[model samples]
Target: MTVRIVTDSSCDLSADDIERHRITVVPLTIRFGDREFVDGRDLPAERFYEMMANSDRLPSTAAPAPGAFETAFRELAAGGADAIVCVNLSFALSATGESAQAAARSLTGEVDVRVVDSGKVSAGLGLMVKAAATAAEGGHSATEIETQLAELKDRVLIYGVLDTLENLKKGGRIGAAQALLGSALSIKPCLDLTSGTVQEAGKQRTRGKARAWLAKKATEVGELEHLAVAHGAADDIDSFVAGLGDTPARHPTTVTLIGPVVGTHAGPGVIALAMVPAT
Candidate 1:
């Protein structure tokens, strides 16, 4: 039986990668005040960040409705796919996983659907989705592919530095005490997603210092199989990668502009590092 892979917009897969792997993507929704746009279709990453900078209202994101997933699944199944593995962003961060599972229940018995909560987001989740697609293309069965992805998912690490605490406060991520403390010292908080929820890992006084800190953390984890640098509109990718020293030599890296769904909460000048351990 032929198997297919599915993921949501939060995976951050590039357009070329999606087409190359024949992977199906369902978009999440983004809200900027009264206006709403589909994550990838209506707002490209570049335009998303541009609108974010100029808009008075901070952008917010929501998972796609179950109908969206249903439509994608039906189309793929019609094309001779006997099974599907739907991977999504962390359940703790969004409802994308729940919606995928609900949509799977409506599929015909000929197509077996399995929903996986990646417990990570952005390129971290992208790494797992890519691995699954590769496995499926190699003729791995649905059960074997799921097992491999689950094991690899735990080894992925993501760390990011937010330019302002204002965005965090606006997103309801911190309390008055933390925000006040951050402001008093000009502290920039470094964040990580361990299981699914974002948590404080450390802090720095400047963007330069934060970039250095993330690079050091990335190296200490282990040998990286895949590494990525994602940034908001205001971040300097060249400086950020250069700070990693020989780390990039050991592992190839890809750089992508952060989209509004992620940038909305992270705000401008956000830089994130995604690393997966070598197998």
Candidate 2:
């Protein structure tokens, strides 16, 4: 039986990669005021960023409905697939994982469906999905693929520095007190996902300082495997890559654009580093 792999838009995969690997991507919904758009579908990265700039209202994102996963799973199962592995963003960050699990449960004995909570978002989750797809392409069983993904999941690390605290405040992620303090000091707070939710790792006063701080943290963590540098509209790939320098050679690196779903919350000029421990 052919093994099938699926994931949600939060994975941050490129179109070419998705098609090349035969991976199915389910998109989350992005709502801007009264208008709604599907991540990667109606709302492509470039257009989403442009809309974000024009609107004062902060865009809100929602996990794809259970039916969305159900449709994808059913299609694969109908195509004579034996089993499926649906990977999604961290359950703590979005309901995508839960929705996938619910859909899988509905499928019951007909098909073997496994839902993996990546415990990471954006390219961090993308890296895991890609690895799983690679394993599937190698003719690995769904169970084995899931095991590899589970092992890789814990090893993944995401660290981000936002350009401003305004988006956080707009998203209701930060309180007025913290926002005031962060703004006054020009504090570029470094963040990482711990226990699924974004949390403060540390902070620096400027972009250069923050970049250096992130690199230092990456080195301290050690065993870097897959490295990713994602940015919002602003292009800081050169400096970000230069900051890593020799550290990136310890692992493979992929740079991607931070799409609307993540960008809406992170704000512009957001630079994130996703690292996986080397085996």
Candidate 3:
């Protein structure tokens, strides 16, 4: 059966990447006071960050309705796709996974839709989506694609340094990284994706040191099969990516702007690194 790929906006894959891989993306909703904007559709990342920087209120996120996923599945099924593999952000972090599964169940005998919890967020999740898309485009069966995705999820690593803790503080909710508080603004916290939730990786006294440590953390994972440098409108990102040692001979690094979903909590000026271990 012909297979297609689907993912939520939180995966952090750009429009170009999605189109290039023929992947379907479902957007999450972002609420700013009285108004709400669709993650990637209505509010672009640049404008969202700009508003974030100027506003004192912390924006909230809501998972897409199950109907959204069902619509996407129905459309793709109508377009001649025999199956769809949907990879979403971690369930530990958001309800997007639950929404996807509900939609999958609703389409029971009609469309073959499989929802996968990446156990990751941001580009870490993006890597798996890309892997699934690549596998499907190569004629891999649905079963084969699912098996590859399961393996890839465990090998993914994500590291990020938030520019401010206010986003987390203002959001009034943090899973297990509560200890990140009680420190002054002088401390920059480095976080990693662990067991589906954001956790404190370490702390740096300055953005400069945090950047270096983030680069160093990537090397600890050994050679990478895929590596991406992501940021929230940070100008030093190019320079920061350059400091990440040397990319493996044939593997060039990918640079993408982090979208609204992940960018909301990571905040503006956040720089991140996501990679998959070499096979």
Candidate 4:
């Protein structure tokens, strides 16, 4: 069976990875005050960060409409795909998954469509999409790929060190991390997004210590199947990744700019690590 993979822009998969795997990405929309732009289409990550820094208010994100996913699924079916599996960011965080499911239901008889909520964002979602696409290329059925993602999502871990809690607080995604607000000035807040919720992991006295804690957390996870570092306009990303010091990974480390959708809430100077512990 010829299987195809689809995902939202939040995954942060590189252009090469998307093109190589023939994965379809439906874009979400970002609004800055009165203006709005498509995630990956009109808005580049650099430009988005520039706009965010200049604007007085935080940007907002909107999930794609069901018609968008429907259109993507139809195009893939026309391309002779026997089945299409869409992996999306967590339902708890956004309505993107619901939009995809609505689209899948609309295509009930015309083609086979399945959607998987990654329970992750950014690099964590990216890694899962890459794996699914690779499995599809190797002729795995939609059911098989879905099953693999079920196990993989649990092993996926996402840790972040935010430069500020202002973005999260303003965006109303602070959740349990709100406790850091009073002391937000004295420390760099570490975040845990592994459970699809923004929870407080810990805080460090300085940026260097916060990033070091991230690398240490990865090391403590033991063997890893995949590893990636994502940052939001962070200039020190290279040095941060270098500190990993020959960490073992089944795949080469992926360093990507956090896209506007995630960067909107993560704010600037955010550095995140995503990894999957080997079974």
Candidate 5:
């Protein structure tokens, strides 16, 4: 059976991976004040960051309508896919997963569409999508892949150091990380997003210290099954990865730019690490 993968723009997977896996990416809407643009389509990351740098208010994101996901599923079914798995951003964070679920319900028996709540965003979500696409390519049944993902989600760990909490504060996504707001001016906030909601991981006086802390945390986790580095237009990404030392993984580590959906909240100069533990 031919299984294809579908995901939203928030996954932050590389273009090559998408093409290689024949994965379909539905886009989310990003609003810069009154002007709205499709994530990654009309509003590329570079352009979004440029506009954000000049704007006084934080941009907002909207989940794609159910029709958008239905269109993607129908197109894939028409292209001869026996089954499709639609992985999406965390259901706890965005309504993207709900939209995909709605679309899947509309398909009924015409085609099989499994909507998975990745419980992650950015490269954390990207890692799961990549694995799903790989499973599809390997001829794994959609049901099997879905079961694998359910187990994989709990093993995924995502941590990041944000340059500022300004975006999180403005976007109202602070969650349990809100306590960091009190000391935002004095320290860089380290966020743990493994739970699909932002929580405080640590605090650092400097960016370098924060990066080191991230690397140390990864080391303490032992060997990794998959590793990915995601950043929001950060220039120090190379150095940040270098500090992580050797990461033993089944696949080569992926370094992806944080797309508009994630970038909207992470803000600029935000760098994060997402990984799965070796089992």
Candidate 6:
């Protein structure tokens, strides 16, 4: 059976990569108080970042409706795709995976639709989607792709340095780590995606120090398979990326913008690095 891959916008795969692999992306919604915009569709990344800078209120994200996934699955099946593997953002962090699963259940025997949760967000999740799409293009079966993703998920590593905790608190996503960044004092919080949720991994007194710590994560991830830098309006992204050393030359690397979904909780001036060990 010819397998196809589907993912949500939180994966943060570039438009070029999506087009090249024929990967379908369902966008999550981002809201600013009373206004709602479809992530990457109604609100362009540039415009979202601009509004975030200008607005006093923090934004929120909503999972895509089940109908969206249903439409995508029916289209792929009609196009001769015998099977589809839908990868999605972490279920622990968002309900996007549940939505995909609901859609898959509705299709039943019409076409094989399997959903897999990467237990990751942004670039980390994007890497798995890209891999699955490439595997599907290479004629791998949906079952095979699913099995590979299961093992691949554990090897992925993601780290971030939040410029402020206002967004996390405002979004109500701040969990145990809220104790560290709950104050208004000037503090740079270093975080990593742990068990599908943002958690405090380290603490730095200043933004520069936090960024340096984030760069060090790449060097620490020995024998890399995929590496990427995720950011949201960080002015020094170039320099921070440079500190990552030559890991980019050794493995496939990308610089992805932290889109609205993750951006809402991460806030502006956030820079993150994700690396996966060779599998």
Tell me, by TM-score, which candidate is best.
4
202-237 per-residue lDDT for model 6 (tens digits): 788888899888877777767787788889988988
Those runs of model 5 whose alpha carbons end farther than 4 Å from true positions after fitting are none
Clashes of each: 0, 2, 0, 0, 0, 0
lDDT of 5 by residue, 1-279 (tens): 999999999999888888888889999999988999998789889888899999987999999999999999999999999999999989988999999999999999999999999999999999899889889989999999999999999999999999989988888889998789889999999999999999999999998898888888778888888888999999898888787667677768878889889999889999998999999
In terms of lDDT, the poorest run of 10 residues in model 6 is 243-252
lDDT of 1 by residue, 152-270 (tens): 87888888887876666677644323634446348878888656677777878887888788888778876778888888876577877777767633457887777667777778888
Candidates' C-alpha lDDT = 0.82, 0.82, 0.86, 0.94, 0.91, 0.86
Q: Write the per-residue lDDT of candidate 4 for residues 233-272, one digit (tens) a residue.
A: 9989989988998888877888999999899989999999
Candidate 4 local distance difference test against the native = 0.94
- Evaluate residue 56 in candidate 6 and report its C-alpha lDDT on the 0 to 100 scale: 83
Query: Alpha-carbon error at 253 in model 3, in Å?
Result: 0.3
Model 5 clash count equals 0
TM-score of each: 0.93, 0.92, 0.96, 0.98, 0.97, 0.96
Q: List RMSD in Å for every model shown.
A: 2.3, 2.4, 1.4, 0.9, 1.2, 1.4
TM-score of candidate 2 relative to the true fold: 0.92
Q: What is the lDDT of candidate 2?
A: 0.82
Q: After superposition, how far is residue 134 of candidate 6 from its true place, in Å?
A: 0.9
